[model samples]
Target: MARENGLQKSLFALLAEAHPEAIVTLQYQYRMNKDIMTISNTLIYDNKLKCASKSVAQRQLDLPHFQQALDSIHGGASCTKQSCWIEQILDPSRKVVFLDTDKMSATEERIMETVVNKAEASIVLQLAEALLLAGVPEERLAVISVYRSQLRLISQSLRGRPGVEIATIDKYQGRDKECVLVSLVRSNETGKTGELLRDWRRINVAFTRAKSKIIIIGSSTTLSTTALFGIFLELMRTNNWIYQLHLGAENEHTIQPPPSPREKRNREHKTHSPAEAILKNRPILRDVYNSSSL
Candidate 1:
């Protein structure tokens, strides 16, 4: 299948099902509270919801290139998720959903066969920064996935973000959103979203919560190989459909490619790694091999 407008507009919206199927022997809660929804294709679902600022006010800012790009709803050519500006989500309409899409891959199964060590734990910084930037009301937003235990610390990171709630996908089973931002954290060849389940139904539950927009941010390679991306790509390949394809783009939200060996040593010595950073800062070390010798 091709990779284009992978998720159609209609495919992004949702309604209550009359005959909901019951497969797992589990019980959960569904909010009948004054359910809130955001315009511009926001959704509420059992698992995730996301939002991007498409406000008229946001559009008119005489900002730099980065800000202008962010203001564009589909700025695929240069869309980014900056740690600083994510606070804009607090404007009462959109909420954020951080996803982890690496379920039963070889990577998941073979982690420290002898040591029951923790998953890389520092990304909590990303989650914390997301909370601040999105400006989402904690009471109105949440965190969900199978990695609840690993992400529990993320809640601590949000103490100032209005005490956001957290849950597993099974728990998200009936709620909906106004604007949804479903993040898929997939570093795997298989795009399972880090859960044993990645069927269209699961994808459906995650996608069909919006009345206006649904934006998925995940491992870009997954789109080329996974069924979820394949389905949408297939649909787009045949039509004039186009959705912004952003992964590790330039401006913001770009993953600083993991440190190479030399870069790692420089960081350990508290020295600048780049020529510009080093020249301007002027660290007194000449040889990274021996910091004291230098």
Candidate 2:
């Protein structure tokens, strides 16, 4: 008999109920590396689901060694694996990190009745370009966000860059990538960031897609309001996987809250020189830029 619904509501149960022996569980996950797997595993730990058989490869590749060898070929001697501005996330050893950013200005745009955070697109483009320069093949990288408008902003910069996919999180649900950069576009002091926080399943899928590295860019203060993200942030702190970009000398809290009358006047009077403008948008080399620069 043909069912009206093309998708079964309980396919797994039906399969198990009909023929217990027909279910063959595939436990081996060849997609994500151990570091990415750890993050994914922690998220699902309480679900009590028997998933991702423990036999997944611990090391996907000798990332540090490879980078060193590449640098040597390029006339740079004794290169470290974490050489770029992405030291917090990209490593040959463990490739997972959380980067906290002061919310850059966002222009609110609506698409399909959903609001999109357009501010994050610039940061996302900077990150993708940095990764490309760091020897991650354009073919194996993806930049995913929850909003189509954000993707559109990124697509403008990444246009004609072959093999690099910029898409919404839903498009990436079943897809895998060697490196995945996620733009968590909402960062506000009031904790009014929308469905992105509430959609944990999409977030899970985004985290699990990376085989080698996962770089999550968002505001720590905003994310800390959510339980899942809070735990993840704490874990990153405990493991030293959290990194922050120092946008300016002023406290970051100033970026999140709406400008008061005095602050608005200060901003209106403030002017950035050409060098400062360049520095703000340019990708930084972590090893080169010391804490003083931050």
Candidate 3:
């Protein structure tokens, strides 16, 4: 049957290859918000993908419900100094978020043949619970991971809520959710992202599965060692979408959001000379300028 359709290729791929002129690529995606679609559009589709409509492109999660949920969870303090990072990532306005775990002790461990990161699992669980508390239906949320062991750990923790899908990234192809929480559980000192993440198709699928918001939890220092993820990190940094997870006393944790574009621009205007502003705006030139004596 596989050979009859096309050996090692999907039937659609085979048809598209045979009838190149007849093939029509879909340019407008209705599943993800424009911000959520940026990664896949820039990396996989060469910026060809666009939002189907302004409403779809600008849609965000329910902010009032999210704030209420945070208040209930944090005892009426929705945006405390320690937990402000949570609000920033969960803020209905933010469609794409990267929760960088580089500063935390989120190392991955090999369980016999499979790999799992307990820290990643715990953070995912917390986020899921908070979303559920925020009035997001279980069916509208999903937790995805590339590692089977990591999925298993998250599944076991979230077993009581079976409606919230917790599965491997490959299982989530052609499926989407209102909110998608991704756990990239491969933190280490040597910066190994594993063979699974090297496949751009998987990354594209994982990133483009959310309708309103997509929150990725991972170690930037480790994942940035790779070419694709290095580009992704730079994109996130440039857009000020990366938030660092800081672990405090008594197992307490905090995440601080990067400055907004306006704030960054204002700071630069005040602190930098004209030449410095030019270098600051162009990071590549800034690196070169720093390395040179002049």
Candidate 4:
């Protein structure tokens, strides 16, 4: 099982490379707006296997209604005529948002044998409830995270609610919905990411799961320290897809770390049994074991 856990060795990976023509890319995306598509494109642009509809013309694009809705919501004359009408209509403050929290608050906890970010979970719950109030169909919305604990926490909050799926990134793969809200739960003084950072495939799966819109709630400051996330946040900034609750606080700052070996030290230690302790206490038995070992 351990040997077969590799992505490259997976059946899907083999099939993808073996028969490229057999794979079909869905060009016409009714799920996400052009802006969301653009952001997603930037994230996976460097991928070896490219999307067939790289050009807008080939993709059969449709006009996003958020701009029209915004005009109606606040009258046409209020907003300046800009190229990014979708953002103007939806408002970055609501559509694509970042909720920052302290390192202490963002700490992970083991619940039901799963690691969950309680701070992030709480924020997602608030957002989900708000979205529900905004008349978003419960069936059309999903809450995704990289940790099972977070999923467990979110699932509990939305319990008995129909059509709302809460899952981890791996579980969300190959699934699409109208809206997805991702909770990137890692936060600390050091810009340390867990196993999730190294798994770009899972990250890609999580980001691309949404059809209409995605609201990402996370610690931008901590995330920007990593290469992949730094690029993701940069694209958000460049595209004006960022919605901030706090003003004049620069959250996305890049500190370029010199390239070196990226090594991760395991923080978890294995537990020893009482029988193991008793064996160690007996020096004569331990010595005989050592002598036979040679």
Candidate 5:
């Protein structure tokens, strides 16, 4: 009886509920690489979503192009030890990346009612610039955040750099970008993930907007406090897609890989069941599963 809008379900929701067998879900997603689409498919679509074709499913960022751009930006200097991690995470072969800010000195600040994280904004801007320098068309790239304050900060810093759209997740709902950079702007010691992030619909929109590459920048320790994000972080760890930012001496940055698979499995085995149980209890997902059972 919990309706999407306050007191009533949308007509579409009502139809789907009344005629579950008549639901004609679109199973083929042509936009995102399969890896980038997995979270939404699993949580919202019941693992029924598929890539339209092998080419679309397997597409990844163009690494050589990015390297060439980096070389140009660095005056043809080879990638130094400090900058190697950038190259590794931005390597063209990676379609989905979770840049864990848990190890970095990144924290969120409140601006009136909205929130912003300077560290997260800085990292997002750096990566967006790198992507542009790598010859990705300005229009093909986007920076999405869940907070208006974070979006405003990024927009102010990115002034004069036209065409790379910066907006909140809701603004980009029906839109797609070739490369999308998401700034999850909630990081605190108390583990308070706000209500906006707790809503799975917005999270689904944020995850499914990218065509080739999607880079999610957030504090894993902080975000893992939420069940949905906990599952997401677990999946990222299982897939070896997490890259932790390590701040070295004199403020150098490095990307650290997750633990070995054996260690990861052992850790996951201890913490996975609660999130699974929570997911199973979610009403929207329960409806999906019930319809499928029919």
Candidate 6:
């Protein structure tokens, strides 16, 4: 399996070489949560969404363009996790779910499993971003976890935002989304790395949950990119992967989004500051929440 994956990695590298602008096929970060939510109690029209003092995600909520993006999401994008999102686009009532670790409340078994197995937790913020753009009300959306405490922090990131709720991956396991957006965060040989396979199976589980499509936000390095000391660097010097994804529609729903830039360490800007949140283990939705301390 590892060797097969290695070949896939080589192909990806070739594709990356010929097409340097390619983004990772594996996509969206995974998240954690605990609970069995039927319907969200929140609303998107709340005042918190309008404040520039919040997540770019929140700021995005109020934009007419953002709403347009959701309305424009007509599908055909290649994602296993995306199947549900596409359906949600076609049918707003379609169920949507996010997967992540959920058992870290006190036992920390899942978290430890992830950590000891070389796991770097991933959060589904981008899938949430796409859903947010697709007009899925936060309340209609659900976040599920394998470990509750592990996901609590991720849940807090989307908290008070409106239209979304949290749940456990177990609850949504048997269910399907119109499309599924599985986010893979950190995958190393640790608990997280071992969980990488489990996560992959879970992702397969998540993908099958979607009746139509599945989109993955994972390590582009897995196939095309390479990770040296945990930093993502491209390896393929030949094939260039973008053309494969861009085989047809030269203009339509085609143009691949740019891969994260080299300076990606600072990509989130002030609003989507994962580092700040990681440092504090709390959501810091501002330009510089650390300014006061600085």
Write one digit per residue (lDDT tens) for candidate 4, span 1-294.
545666445687789899998997554554454555665667774433333344521232123443443333233233334532223323433344444454334665555655567766665665564445445667878998887767777777666454688888888877887678888877666777777765777887887777656777677777888888888888777767665433212121111211222211122212555545767779898788778879
TM-score, per-candidate, Cα-based: 0.38, 0.63, 0.77, 0.61, 0.78, 0.33
Q: Which stretches of candidate 3 lie over 4 Å from their true place?
A: 1-19, 75-83, 248-250, 253-294
Q: Whose lDDT is higher: candidate 1's or candidate 3's?
A: 3
Global lDDT of each model?
A: 0.37, 0.65, 0.80, 0.60, 0.80, 0.36
Q: Give the TM-score of candidate 5.
A: 0.78
129-235 per-residue lDDT for model 2 (tens digits) = 54565666778899888877677777776764647888888888789888888888777767656866667777888888887778887777777888888887887
Tens-digit lDDT string for candidate 6 (253-293): 32122224333445546466566556665445443566765
Indicate the worst ten consecutive residues by lDDT in candidate 5.
249-258
TM-score of 3: 0.77
Let me know the TM-score candidate 6 reaches against the reference structure.
Answer: 0.33
- Poorest lDDT segment (10 consecutive residues) of candidate 6: 32-41
In terms of TM-score, which candidate is stronger, 5 or 6? 5
Scanning candidate 2 in windows of ten residues, the lowest lDDT window is 248-257
Using TM-score as the measure, name the better of candidate 1 and candidate 6: 1
Model 3 residue 109 lDDT?
Answer: 94
Residue pairs in candidate 5 whose N, alpha carbon or C atoms collide under 3 angstroms? 63-92
Q: Count the backbone clashes (under 3 Å) in each candidate.
A: 37, 1, 0, 3, 1, 73
| Cα lDDT tens digits for candidate 5, 127-149 | 77667777788798899988888
